[model samples]
Target: MSTAAAPAPPGDPALLTGAGARALFRAGLDTDTVGWAAASAQANLIAVPRADAYDLLLFAQRNPQACPLLDVTDAGSPATALAAGADLRTDLPAYRIWRDGEVVEEVADATPYWRSDMVAFLIGCSLTFETALLEAGVPVRHLEEGVIDPMYVTDRPTRGAGALSGPLVVSMRPVPAHQVAEAVRITDRYPDVHGAPVHVGDPAGLGIADLGRPDFGDAVTVGGDVPVFWACGVTTQAVVAASRLELAITHVPGRMFITDVPHTAYRR
Candidate 1:
């Protein structure tokens, strides 16, 4: 299926919990009111069936950089022990239903997509790193400017597996030259969620010459002090696109499945 540009709608800030977000997502999907990216980004989801959780976790294992494993619950259970205690079927805002590698329909609830064979996977996100950067007083242009992070498909390649493997995708952050090393040191601690940058300094070193453009997220300013590049969770999109799996699920870039686990846990 072709990629459709999702429309940007003002999301209700009140829908923060997995249950609340899922309900809104389902309503939005039923009405086709929110864009694909917006729905997935803001929605909170729970994976009920053991099989669905297994499949999702396995997919993440197959692609570590893009789908860094987070947490999983007991088999056939709806609530995850770590993230939130919301029902998986009704919590997410929307789900893009797929069948045998094809985009069949966009559904509000994945309960219809759930089979006894399905599994839920909680992939790591770039938002954690961004938070680290901001905390360290690093200049994150996009967030400061109220824009999306600029992502690009670099010529660099990533490790691959049976159904996963694709180009190395990098998320650009214009960090001031002075704090680049600090950014690396701070983010390096969260290995489970794409810790540390894959590259630093020059984009050309990573075979990326241009900074004005990106492959996935929006672009922001790159001043003299701002050096570019970091590993991204969005790389999973490329792997998903390349593998062309019969079916897959992921959080939209910028939007993520926010867990109840505190940021301190990731530091360990």
Candidate 2:
């Protein structure tokens, strides 16, 4: 849970100067996370102007479950990040472009996807919830087995806004019968990202009949204990698919948009 701060590479002289570094450094004092680390990495590669940030945030906002809003860069300039020090254009390991809800391409760099009107948004993931489970001694099988957590589409629906609304997506973890209450207590502290369990026990209660085959991520063994489900950041993507917008983007399932802000920020 504790790690050293990663150093940001340098940015382009024409697009970014040392000023951005100062801004990022100040922001980092308040928050830090893996996604922020990637953003800092990109600032060294190219200019992530405010325009680029706008595109990134707008994309995330349009698809909140998948792209939670973490931090944003200034609108015209690239120097200040509202949340983390990382730049948006280069830090991410991969970027997916979608046309009318269909992903058309995947690339390492998002510079081509950059447009002045766009904004960046960072969504919450089950990572924070998993942390709470681990602290309570609830075995998180996916992490233990070195596999991604299993995700499934449920009959549950989320609050719809703008063009986003669809069936809820959830990430599952098997909790011992003894620690279920402990898991709930620890996670209830944060709600900005999905907070607390949406469903517990039978998966069928949420329209998920098969635990062995998941709609996304990998499946893990479910012992004689209860199978727990939490709201997923990817739920927004399901909404996007249902909306059928002309253009949309999201991180691949399991692949997430990291941010500099600590997971604790969601407590607010």
For each candidate in the order shown, give its overall lDDT on alpha carbons: 0.58, 0.57
TM-score of 2: 0.70
Work out candidate 1's RMSD over C-alphas: 6.3
lDDT of 2 by residue, 4-91 (tens): 5644544431133223433443333222122223222111111123423443345455545444444443443322353345455544
Off by over 4 Å in 1: 1-65, 73-78, 98-107
Give stretches of model 2 more than 4 Å off.
1-83, 265-268
Question: How well does each candidate superpose onto the true structure, as a TM-score?
Answer: 0.73, 0.70
